[model samples]
Target: MWDYSDTVKEHFFNPKNARAMDDADAIGDVGSIQCGDALRLTLKVNAESEVIEDAAFQTFGCGSAIASSSVLTEMIKGKTLDEALKVTNQDIASELDGLPPEKMHCSVMGREALQAAVANYRGEVWKDDHEEGALICKCFAVDAVMIEDTVRANNLRTVEDVTNYTKAGGGCSACHEGIEEILTRVLAETGEAFNARASRQKLHASKEKPPVPGKGMSNLERIKRIERVIEMVRPQLQRDRGDVTLVDVDGDTVFINLVGACSGCQMASLTISGIQQQMMEDLGEFVRVVPVPANHAATTGVTA
Candidate 1:
């Protein structure tokens, strides 16, 4: 289970502003059914163009969602419209005491809902400055420049390859549109062709492992063993400026991705085949270790 923050747990168990305002000047609704988190906010503006009257919200989400909405309402209740608009998503996240990395977007949604409500009141169009130019990543709020920089720095080629450098479409699948756009921009900007053979060669080299005969293990057991090994060896690997993750397990061979400060470090290749490989070997002879490429696939948002 997720460790809920004290403030987040309190708001979740006993949410405030859980109803619509009777004479609300504006109402905003944002979210998609696919994401399983939605919010509805109502605001009543006073004569001085401030939110002096009242505010309320209804949220269908996990603790983060409920806390984000509840806290947002409380924060904006007595503030002027301008002050309320200044309450950023980061502000909301911080007010909740904190939210998990994945849940940061929920706080972001709360901010979006508030902005939408204000815009609805003013009859203004909604625009995301984060996507003013280039292209927009519908999935993770990333822009073309962000995707291109990540790809070029990491030497990524395919759509999946982009995931490692930048988590563009790793969130809501709705962002696939933005991914395709960024991919096109990258291809056009580079004017360089993708070499299928080279890509395959890189992938294959990353998956190297000696063949092991007939020693079988259930997938769950292998996964559990891999997880244990990952936790045990992570600190040691980090000491050498590297981190490891279980990518895939085929038969007895376990594929791992070494990343972060270690990605392009001088000893990366050696550490993967030497230290990590040796550690897994102690587990079982059939456990062949492979160093999957840094650019393998996008990390889907953490499972809630």
Candidate 2:
């Protein structure tokens, strides 16, 4: 069973503003019941001051979802619409002490609802269909823009991190590749390295063994695990304004391309040796880390 925080349980058992406001000045609706989560937020704004006088929510989801929506209403109660727009999903999670990573998507839902509500009040066109970006996760109706924004907002690294925060790859695993592509682009753009250990510590804290490697592992699984290991060593490389990108993995051989300062550094061999040692330790297998030329075209796999 998932552990529920005390504040989360309190709101779940007795949620505030759980009713519909007949005199609401604006209403924001998001999510789909077909996707197993939906939320409707109502607000009563003072026309002259543009401050939210009242707020309420009616949500169809798990306890965390209800609590998130319930708490969001309270958070926005006396704040102006502009002020309330600044509230992020992280703030909602922080307000409730903390939520299980799996339930973090509930907080994201609440943040979207708030945005929708504010947009409605301002006569803007905002809908859950997410027409701005291509739909990446058909099961959850998550779009590329949503995934990219969440990744930037939370500094997400792995597909698992995106799944936890946005529910993009949580359903059918088909969108995993799309999510990874987005992560790579966003992290590269910001020059931010993925912290694989920190993002996944909670989930693996109790596991004694790392996943078995190189047995019947599929190509995608190998790439994912390889990328994780690269992310683990990326910070060290990034410290010197250098980075490594996973180009391809053929059997036990991993192809990588060094970029920036490490591209032609004298210590590139030592860095590759360190990465090889780390990969062997983490993957529980002997592997070769080969550096490709800077302009090498990768046939398959993802950059870390």
Candidate 3:
């Protein structure tokens, strides 16, 4: 279980500024179907010119969402249009004292909803330059640059999926909501543009890695690489019923697979003891045999 800070617990239980404005001049709403977090922001802006008169929010998710929304409402109240636009997820996180790495996205989302709502109020549009060739999240179809900017700006989601896919955390596990922020921004900009973004990510994933020049090595030279091939190939061998995952490495080690009938076959122990043991022994002391399994484990009977 994660340790909830006192501030987090307090805000979770008693989130401030938790309501919807009856006479809101502008409104913004964001939701994530996968993570199950949603927020609605309302603003009362000064007419004649775009200035914020008041702000409020309603959120549905964890304590982080509630606290973020509550704090965001307090932060933007009485601020002018320009000043309120500057309010970011990081500011909300700071106002709450601080949030956990994962919950940072909640604060960040509140800020975006505010921005979207404010933009809706005015006739202005945020036309990003890299909208065409942006790298969306590989997982969630979030734009890369937008996610990066959102993470830096809001200090939200740190998980890799969130960062790359949604602008929460794409590169690593700590920032996910950042990915969601990017998704939200993109969806707001072009609600039906998800298809293009997803296709781009797929294209990137299917591309083969180009061979590096001058880095090529022969099979014999490469087999001598590293200390443990046994552990690496265990699962691969298991897939072929202990047939062959790793082939004979120059009569030293024989590569075998453990799959089909041999994966969970009752004769697995017999195969290991008879054929595997005899092959390794016949190969001599310096000779090593590598067996690759299908699922996880692999075995290499060698040290050097």
Candidate 4:
């Protein structure tokens, strides 16, 4: 069973702006019965200010999909088109207090519907995704560019992460191979190899006395190694207006403190686990992580 957060349940049961707008300036209706999820998004814009005067949605799918649509409409209201364009799937998930990873595509669908709706309003082509590259996932109409962008943006490593984030290989299992190819290229572009032991190999192969990648190292060296990996991870979190501060390290147990938009989120523990997983993958299985209590960080006045 999956844990549906309070925010997701709240919006699912009592959705906001879940209605058809006959007078909408622009409308985007997308998805299919095959996918078990579809969204129709409508918007009314202020002619002069270009602000979104109102937004509404009609979604057909799971509770998360409906909640995602409801929350997306609520979040973009009163914002300018450009501001709304900046709202990503991560923002929708965060607004819902975070979704189960497998349901993340529901949030992605909401963002896509909004973009399609906005494109209609501006008299632009509804899907410019093709301009980025050829189509890869026929089931969801996912293209190469979209897949690559999602992989790089989230630092996704596994085939499952790609499916969860982009819905590319979620349909037929055939695209899994293609998605893996793209993921490999993206990871290569980061100048790092995939596999949980790749970084360890790098450490062992180096002669410059660089910090080793796991346990049984000096505290200072271990901290240096972990901090280096965090440097790679933090920017993605910060891009979503969330942050994690290193509180302390105890053997395999690493402590982190969430900050910024993530500070009050109900899914902070999930976020911490994600951080831990990434860190362990990079450094080794010897590492585990937990979020430090807010009270502790508060008293210590630590910033993420």
**How many clashes (backbone N, Cα, C below 3 Å) per candidate?**
1, 0, 77, 0
User: Deviation in angstroms for 161 in model 4?
Assistant: 14
Tens digits of per-residue lDDT, candidate 3, 1-304, equal 5466667677778887778689988888776656588888898888866667788788889888887887777778888878888886667776787676546667768877877787777755633233212434332234566565554555432243332223222233333343444545555554433233553474365343232222354555445441244454455444432443444454444555555545554445444444443333332233334445444232344444
How well does candidate 3 score on lDDT at residue 289?
Answer: 43
Q: Cα lDDT of model 3 overall?
A: 0.57
Could you give the candidate ranking by TM-score, starting with the highest? 4, 1, 2, 3
Q: In order, what lDDT does every prediction score?
A: 0.71, 0.82, 0.57, 0.78
True-structure lDDT of candidate 1: 0.71
Better of 1 and 4 by lDDT: 4
**Per-candidate TM-score against the hidden true structure:** 0.48, 0.47, 0.42, 0.54
What is the C-alpha local distance difference test score of candidate 2? 0.82
For 11-125, candidate 4 gives per-residue lDDT tens digits of 9999999898989998988787876888999999998888999999998899999999999999999999999999998889988988875677788888889889889988988
- RMSD of every prediction: 14.8, 16.8, 18.4, 9.0
Task: Summarize candidate 1's per-residue lDDT along 78-103 as a digit string, tens digits.
Answer: 99888899898878977898777557
Instruction: Give the higher-TM-score candidate: 1 or 2.
Output: 1
Off by over 4 Å in 4: 128-304
**Residue 134, model 3: Cα distance from true site in angstroms:** 19
